[model samples]
Target: MPVSSATSTAESPPAAVPSATVPHSWEYDGTEPFPEKEPAAPRDRGERLYVAVTAAIVLAPFLALGLAGWLLWGRLIHPADIVLALVLYTVTGLGVTVGFHRGLTHGGYRAVRPVRIALAVAGSMSFQGDVIGWVATHRRHHAFTDRPGDPHSPYRYGTHLRGQLRGLLHAHVGWLFRNSRTSAARYAPDLLADRDIRAVSRAFPALCLLTLALPFGLGWAIGGTLVHALTALLWAGLVRIALLHHVTWSVNSLCHVIGDRPFRTRRHDRATNLWPLALLSFGESWHNLHHADPTSARHGVDRGQLDPSAAVIGLLERLGWVSDVRWPTPDRVAARRV
Candidate 1:
C-alpha cells in the first residue's frame, strides 16, 4: 500500500479567548483525502472469454513442449538438471517471496538502492508482471480481501463444488486475462513516483524473454548440447512458471478455502496455513499468520514452520541493508489467535 502522511498543528488560542485565560484549539488532517473510491468497472464477458481462450492457446503449446522434452530428454535425472532446478527455483522464488511480496508489497523492511533495484529486476524476470502492477494488485487483494472487489477471490462464485472449481481456475490464472487492470494511483502511488520502478516495469517483456533464454543459455554452456538446453528450458522456464503461478494463486484460492486457520481474521477473511506448499512457495504457505499480520516480515512465526523468505529478510537486516523490519512480536501473534 502507498505510504500515508498526516499534518497537525499544536493547540493555539482561539481568536476570542479571554485575555486572562488560555484557550486551546487543535486541528490535524491526513494526506490529501483519498479520492472517493469508484466502483469497479463491469467486466466484459466477451473480453474475458477471449482472454481465457487466448491464454489457453499460448499456454497449450508450452505444455506440449514440456511434455515432449520430458519424454525425450527427461528419462534420466541428470545431476546438472537437479542443481539448475534448485538454483533457478531459489533465485526466482526468492525474487517473488522476499522481493515482491515482502520488500515491495508490505515494506517489511527497507532495502538499499542496489538491493532494491536487483530485487525488482529479479522479480520481473519471474514474469509476474512489473513491480508496480504486482504491488497494486496485491494491495487491492488485501484491501477487499474476499469481498466483491477482490480481483481473485475463490469465494466469488459461492461454495458449490462446480462454482468452486470455476473459482479456482479463475483465481489461479483467469484473472490475468481480463482487460481490467488495478489502479496504481490508488494502490501503489509510492512505486509509481519512482522513475527506476517505472523503467523496470516498462522492461517487463524484455525481462520475460531473458527468463526463458537464460536457462537455455546456461544449459548449453554446461552440457554443451541443444537437447540439454531444451530440457533445462522446460524444467526451469515453463514448468517452473506454471508451478510458481499455481502456488502463488493458491494463496488466493486454496489458502483461503482450506488448511488450518490458527489465527483470527476479519469476518470472511479465511486465510489458512497449508504445510504442503511451504517449500514450493518459499514459506508463503503459512498464510494464516500472513493475513493476521499483513505487514509483519515473518509469515511463519510459529515454531518449526520454515520461512526462507523471512530468513533472507533477517539476513538483509543484519547486513544493514534493510532497517525497520516488522518482525512479529509474541503479543501481537497471541492477540490474533483463533
Candidate 2:
C-alpha cells in the first residue's frame, strides 16, 4: 500500500482502512534520483501557434465578456444564461478534477467503459490539453513539486514579494506558454499505451468545438432565437471555460502561496487547502490532503469539507459505473495529521 515519499496517509493503520484498502499511492519525493527528463529539444515561446492559442483562451474571454456587459447592458447576462454556464461548468470542471486528475492520472478508482469515455470526453472539453498531456503535466508536477524541475512551482523565483508576484503569474498561466512541454513519454507512458485514451486525446480539438457548439445549440433549441444561441456561446462556452481554467490553475498558484496546510506532507511541497474554492473547484481545493494522500479518491475527508467530485464518484460506484474507490477513512486522516 506504500509507494514513496509523498504519501504520508496511504500507509494508514489497519483501524483506519480495512486492510489498508486504498489501491494506489501517488507520492513523489525527488529521492528517486532525478534524471534529465525534459525534452532535449524543447519548444519555446517562439512557437507562435502555442502562444496564440494560449493567449486566446486565457485573455479573449475577459475582453469579450467585459465589452459585452458594457454594450448590451441588461440584455447580456440573463438568468437562463447563468444557469447554462453553471451546468456546463460543473460537467467540464468535474471532467478536469474527477476525470483527468483522479481517475486518469492517479487511478483512484476503476471506471466502467462508458464512464471512462464520458470522463475523457468531458475532460477534453475543458480546454486543459488532451487527457494524456494533462496527466503527464500533473504527474510531472507531483514528481518534482516545488523543486527545480516542477513545471509550475511558485517558488521558482526568490522568496521576496516581488519575486513571489513573478512566481505567482508564472504558476498561474505563464508556464503554459513556455517553450518547454512536459515529457509525456516519460510521465504518461501508461496512457500512451491505451488506444481508447489515445483516440480521445486525438479528438481533443474536435471536442473543443463540440463543447462550445453544444451550448449554443442547446440555447437556440431552448429559446428558439439566434440571440439566445449567441448568449449561450458567450456565457456557457467562453466565460465558463475561462472561469474553470483560472480556478484549476489557482490550485497551482494560490494554493501553494496561501491557504491552510491541515495535513502533513514533504516540507517543500507547500500545497494547501483553500476552503473558498471547495465548491467551485469540485473539492479539488483540498489540495494539502491531496498531496498527503494522492490516490485516496476523496480529498475532503473532514465532515464539513465539501467535495462534489468525490460524491459523484460515490454515486457512480453505487450505480456500478466505477469500482475500487479509495474513499478516505478516519484512520488515514489521523495518521497524516500535522
Model 2 gets an lDDT of 0.80
lDDT of 1 by residue, 54-84 (tens): 5863485458456956665748444565577
What TM-score would each prediction reach against the true structure?
A: 0.82, 0.86
lDDT of 2 by residue, 1-338 (tens): 11121132122221211223222352324333222233446455567778898888788776766866774686666667789999989999998898988888877888887888899889999988899889878887786677656789787675677778888998998888774587777677777877888999999999999989988998898888998898888888888888898899999999988999989986568899999999999999999999888888999988799999999999999999998888888899899989
TM-score for candidate 2, residues paired by index: 0.86
Total clashing pairs in model 2: 2
Residue 229 of candidate 1: its Cα lDDT? 88
For model 1, the superposed segments whose C-alpha errors exceed 4 Å read 1-77
Clashes of each: 0, 2
